[model samples]
Target: MAPWLIAAILTQGALALGLLWYLGTIRIPMVMRGEVRIDDIALERKGWPKREWQASNAFDNQFQLPVLFYVGAGLALYFGPTSLEVALAWLFVVTRYAHAFVHITDNHVIRRFAAYFAGLLLLCLFWLDLAVRLVLSL
Candidate 1:
C-alpha cells in the first residue's frame, strides 16, 4: 500500500475521533445527570446541541466526498502511485480536516466552503489523472 493510502485511512480515523469527542461531551453528561429521557434526545422534537449537530454533520460529510477519495486512492495503489497523486490525496485530507475544524469552531461558511471546494478540486485532479492513465493505456 502507498504511504498516502495509509494517511488517508488514518485521516478517516481522526475524523471519527472528532465526531466521538464532540457528541460524547454532550450526550454523556445528559445521561449521567438524568436530565433528559431516552426519547427526549432520541425521538422527541427537541433540537440537538449546536456543536454536536455540527460534528455529526461534518461526520456525514466525510462519507459523501471521501468515498471518491477512497476509490481514487485504491485505484492509485493498483496502478502504482505517482508523487502528484499522493500529494493531491494529502491535500484532500488536510482540507477536510480544515473543513471540520471550521465547522466545529465559529463555522464561518466562507472558510468552510473554501476548504471543501479545495478538496473537491483535489478530487477532480485525481479523477482526471485516472482518466488520462486509462486513455494512455489503451
Candidate 2:
C-alpha cells in the first residue's frame, strides 16, 4: 500500500476510534444514569438528547461513505495507485473530518452538506482515476 494511503486510512481509523470513545464513555453512561431510555435508543434513538443524537448520527455516518473508501483503498492497494488517487483519498478524509466536526459540534446543515458533497466529489474522482488506469492498462 502507498504510504500516503496508509496515513489517510489510519487517520480515518483514529476518527472512528474517537467517535466510539464518545459513544461509550459519554452516551452509554447517559443511558446508565437514566438520562435516556434504552428502549428509545433501541427503537430509533427518538428520545436521545440532541447532543447524544448528534454524536450517534456522526458515528453512523462514518460507515456510510467510508465503506466506499475502504473498497477503493483495497482496490488501490491491489492495483497500485498514482499520486492523483492518493491525493483524492487524502482530500476525502479531510472532508469526512470536516463533516463530522460540523455535525457533532453545531449540527450545521449547510456546512455538513458542503463537507459531504466535497468528499463525494473526491471519492468519485478517486474511482474514476482507478477505472481509467485499469482501462488504459488493459
User: lDDT for each of the candidates?
Assistant: 0.81, 0.88
- Residue 18, candidate 2: Cα error in Å is 1.4
Task: Score every model by TM-score.
Answer: 0.87, 0.92
Please give the lDDT score for candidate 1.
0.81
Off by over 4 Å in 1: 44-46
Task: State the lDDT of candidate 1 residue by residue for 20-79, as single tens digits.
Answer: 777678767866777656667777426455666777777778888888888888888888
Which pairs of residues collide in candidate 1?
none
- RMSD in Å for all candidates: 2.0, 1.5
TM-score of candidate 1 relative to the true fold: 0.87
- Residue range 1-138, candidate 2, lDDT tens digits: 398898998898888888978878767788889988888778676888888878888999999999899899878978877788788889999999999999889988999999999999999998888888789889
Identify the candidate with maximal lDDT. Answer: 2
The alpha-carbon deviation from the true structure for residue 133 of candidate 1, after best TM-score superposition, in angstroms, is: 1.0
Clashes (candidate 1): 0
